[model samples]
Target: MQDRIEITVTDGVADVRLVRSDKMNALDAAMFKAIEEAGEQLRNDPSVRVAVLSGEGKAFCAGLDMANFAAMAEGGKSSEHKGGAKAVPKTLAERTHGIANQPQYAGWMWRELPMPVIAAVHGVALGGGLQVCLGADIRYAAPGTRLSVMEIKWGLVPDMAGTQLMRHLLRDDVVRELSYSGRIFTAEEALTMGLVTAVVEDPYEHAMTLARQIAGRNPDAIRANKRMFNAANYLSAEDGLMMESVEQDAIIGTPNQIEAVMAELEKRPAHFKD
Candidate 1:
């Protein structure tokens, strides 16, 4: 895990970063498993109220490693191999992480987290890197950041929750055009396409600012909100309203909610537990 990502927890905000600067944080076999392992930890950590995802060096990521394409060119699957042994869950179709397979979960697990996640995107976020950004609740991209749905260039389609996550963020035509062309678009273009929340000079600082704001909120209410918003994606209007009502009812009189009320009444900050 240390070879692939770095995770630090501070003041209820979990800072997660890809650490493979030499390769522009590109996804290789180890990186795929490492991301899944990190996601698993974040999923179970109750102290986390907010999270920020970023890359350590020049780029958020430059898509799949060249070795992955090499494997494809040789008509073999891309997976981890060590000491003449192969990892289990040998295929991409297995549901190894609840609703997603291991590779897909490397990106989708952020969506499954109970708290809000902000991605600080800079440099090139292409292919799988772009899908990882899509998994976040919000994305803050740096000015001039290069992003693309680049699977088409590799004779592929967007399979890493890009189809699932992107529908909520982009128009059908724009998604199709990007997918079809695999063209790298600027951060400004991503803003117009709604693929990013904001294009800022410093995406990391902006993301951290937003994360701290969210971390200050009542954690129970934050979790409740995440649930409601995620549910709204698949539920009908009538059903969505019903689900919202149920979630709101569950949160209205909770201990954390009461703390939020008292803090406001007393003009003091609130402290919440997971």
Candidate 2:
């Protein structure tokens, strides 16, 4: 609902775009709230089967706004929670938002959403920006797009769930080097590190193509797939197999599932209930 972020749903796909062109869609207090709320909207809206996240103007996001660092220099406490949130935590130990704090939720909310979220990344995705991209179920980056774990430059670590996501995607040494150096890397390098799914000329186009295809799928099956993929990272092999069966049981023979079967049998597109 925030002007900084916009959400438009069409054909069961939610297009979430960060619209702060003057700042290259940088993360500020309001931007963080907007991003978190945007994800929540997609999460709660049953009409949305998938989400495609992108940024307007020059970049996906240029990371934390410079004003934040200026505030720190001026002796004001510089943290991710800047606006609206009055009871922000003083430290990481306190849980301000579910399992993650507020800033982390800005990105982590995508993972928490039952449906798949695809990020179409271009321009700069640095520090918090990069972490936001990491939140998606998949990421597509334009060629030469720059990315970094930029918190180190400001004497901070990535507090936006980037570390946990990076551990799953990149090698430990790679994650360490990026976090330690805060060196910007290209989308090609991101793809090589598994940080990005693909590097293309136009990431938004690729992201939309995939998102629409995914949206056309049965919502129950798609949700089940997301559940399995999410559990894959944390659960053991035995538990994962059992969990898969449990999810299958919940989806199998359901109205939508049966519709999918009938559609395939009749050689037609499925008209699934959202």
Look at candidate 2 and tell me the lDDT of residue 96.
Answer: 72
Regions of model 2 farther than 4 Å from truth:
78-83, 86-89
Q: How far out, in Å, is residue 18 in model 1?
A: 0.5
RMSD of 1: 2.0
Residues 1-274, model 2: lDDT tens digits: 4678999999998889999989999878888778777877787899999989999999999988887778767666655554575222346667777899888887788888999999999999999999998989999999999999999899899999998888989999999999999999999998889999999899998999999999888999999898899889999999999998899899988999999999999999989998
lDDT of each: 0.87, 0.88
lDDT for 95 (candidate 2):
78
Q: In model 1, which range of ten residues has the least summed lDDT? A: 81-90
Candidate 2 clash figure, as a count: 0
lDDT of 1 by residue, 147-174 (tens): 9999999989887888999888899999
- Per-residue error (Å), model 2, residue 211: 0.8
